[model samples]
Target: MPRISHPRSSSTPLHEGGELALIERIRRRAGGGASTALRLGIGDDCAILRPRAGEDLLVTTDFSLEGRHFRRDWHSPQSIGHRTLARGLSDLAAMGARPMAAFLSLALPPAVARDAGWLEGFLDGLLDLAKQHGVPLAGGDTSESPSEQVLADIILLGSAPRGRALRRSGARVGDLIYCTGTLGGATAEFAQVQDGRGGKTQTASSMNPHLFPQPRLAAGQALLRRKLATACIDTSDGISTDLAHLCEASGVNAEIDAASLPLHPLAQQLTQEAAMAAALHGGEDYELLFTARAATKMPRKLGGVPLTCIGRVVAKKRRAPQVTLIAADGSRSALAAQGWEHLR
Candidate 1:
């Protein structure tokens, strides 16, 4: 709850950006793009997304709920907005889908509903990412919520060349597992933010992983376009847990070399067990997790982010767990699929 602030500035009156007017401003601010995939965007009853010839459309939605996913005292409106959209984009990245259009449904509590500046700040964060990704803002509904929290649901529409989108079920025995960037930062960031509540100063730097997570869009595109990966997924649910998803879908078992993990520098400061747990089980890093045939060579870095090979695919026996971890001392143990759950 560090750096908490009201959604609006105290100097401005609440009526500056009314509902209709605010919607119009958002529509205009989102007009910088000219993506061909969009046939109709904002200001319509329904948005239209046109997939390219021989391409398949992909759609994903993410819900951002106040109090559960975010605490008003912990997140700025802008950061909340950015992270909400980023969650859906991360799903698209996992499938190597090219971003096309987005739909946002915002339900605001009465207190924050009238704060035009707060709404603008939130839209600014969302639209800035839309422009950067070349994804147009499409139509979605907005309403006042009776609850005391803000809720946002973002639906992202994307496309991938016909039959080329990555899937969790594609991994085969002998495939090498790779992950992008460092792990465990989001866990640390979450803890730091929670600890600094009540207006206490923050000890974490501005580059807190929770506040600013980049979708591995380019890396995912490369994986599919180049046929480099046999399977793919994003790491919002933690490495250990997501790996289980991949293995279960592919009907395989996995072995991760704990020492080979691309650990965050902060891991060095934590106790050994804590560092390992955080790196393997922390959530929301939004990095890409992929599998490639052992014979295939992959880039050491993509989009300036390092990719480290940490594990490999193995055949799964009936009644066996989907994942296992190998310690530095060569001890092996079942890797539990424990991570952040939206419903938990």
Candidate 2:
């Protein structure tokens, strides 16, 4: 079952400084970037981003809603902020795009806005990741929330070589399905946090996979540069769900060797059945799930992330399951889209 945490109480509110003052503070923290792509950033009505010669611009947007995306008590402000931006970055990564700039629109309720500590922590988390990715905070809107919750929307702009960005519909029959890194770490950590077995630390360490998922941007870019993948999609949703997406988009079906799944160390802590379930249905891993030709010789790892061949694309058969998982015992079963679904 999912859990929601209590809201923190604060004596101060963000309204005290007005919107302009808050924007100034964020601008100072975000600082001016050296990226030649961003000719103008915050303080302007709109940001100007210069795409590289012969590059195609890509844009992605996402929403982070309190109680839906996160809980204030369970997730640190830093984690919340980091996740808000990560959601968009992961989308860019899915299509083999390099992040150029980011725009954030934040709406804070009275309770949340009153806490300066929380706000600063959120900015620190967001700005840190932005800096690491060379993505400057460009321009966005800010307003007060009508409800007692925090709402964040981020837009990420990226660029890729013209006519070369990866797509879900490009996969062909006989292509091998590959995924970057281990599976189910985020879902495993979320269970721990919900059970009160995980600490609410501000540090977004690698171990806190649920709180801080690292987007596989480098691997996506490498795939484009090397022509290593015919299709690509990020596993923001679990493999079972995401694989179905790839299959549907490519008008194909797939078969997965269940034993070949690279379960996360965190997920391995669970019972065997639970671990398998988590790996198949877990969401928000932010790893890339891609397809390459069977004849393609792939490196053991791309961008320092392990690549695992877990499945293969097949021709779509009438009345056949979109995805089939083959168990160690030689049993096969349908793999449903059991991961996260909005308004479910």
Candidate 3:
């Protein structure tokens, strides 16, 4: 008889029931409330909400895991803490909502919890970013974990005028697509840090892009105020994948001009190919990609942020559901829809 092998039981408390299974369990535990504003509760980019006759609300949540989302060796406790808050805040920005407050939940291992000063520094970093955006830290929970990893969950709540918040499914065919700020710089810097090349000698610009990402709140708000964007989504999962998401949600396809993509100076300096691959496939850019009417006259800059017109939405005519890239020579090629899919 052949010997049989059995899978080892998971020691990590968080992973004991598996991540997806845990989320499903929590979903079942949650009870419904009598809130007219809570249009969507969970299972979407952000929770859709309409407050009162004159108000709308947007709520979003994001989580950061030490080993999977970040590493202590590569990032300071401050950077990690700031990013944990920024991620959820960026989602609020994407919906063109004015941020109000945030709730944070931290799960710390015994090793990390033993350092009181480190914990203070982490909270300081989180508070600093929250204050800069005029977002208050409302409340949260802390728990000790058996693993050697630190995890944080941030929930943000923001409000907008009734029927004014942007959604991913509003894009129409022939709408011009635009992106705020250049891309790929963050991924390049992350690559350097992961390769052990990031040290005291690294340039400020290179480190800043990766360490600190600004959530384009003002720009998104302005876009909504002007009714310039028909559809909007933040580029946390890279331009290519996010565009695919917008197109998918809108029941359309997109054609991007490769030559028109905005390349950050750092991305250009670091890679001769302009890091277009990273810009297209790398995550964590936190920039906004929105679509507007083709004939719409958008300002060169919005709220002091530069906006670059890069592509347009097109009707899907029997083509495989994907975004197409048009080269400078007018040759068209299909772009992959792959990005940072958590399950993969």
- Report the number of the highest-TM-score candidate: 2
Per-residue error (Å), model 2, residue 271:
0.7
Rate residue 244 of model 1 by lDDT.
85
Q: Give lDDT per model, in order.
A: 0.79, 0.86, 0.74
Q: What is the C-alpha local distance difference test score of candidate 1?
A: 0.79
Candidate 3 versus truth, CA RMSD in Å, comes to: 9.4
For 1-344, candidate 2 gives per-residue lDDT tens digits of 01111225533344777666667777787775567898877776677777889999998889999989999878889888888988999999889999998988888886666678888999988988888788888878776676889988898999999999999999999999999999989989999888876637677777888888888899999999999999999998888888888888899999999999999999999999989988888879899999999999999999889999998999999988889999999999988888885211
Please provide TM-scores, in order, for all candidate models, with all chains considered together.
0.90, 0.94, 0.82
| Clash pairs (backbone) in predicted model 1 | none
Better of 1 and 2 by TM-score: 2
- Model 3 TM-score is 0.82
Sort the candidates on lDDT, descending order: 2, 1, 3
Higher-TM-score candidate of 1 and 3: 1
> Which scores higher on lDDT, 1 or 2?
2
Evaluated at residue 102, the lDDT of candidate 1 is 85
Which runs in model 1 stand beyond 4 Å of their true positions?
Answer: 1-18, 197-206, 341-344
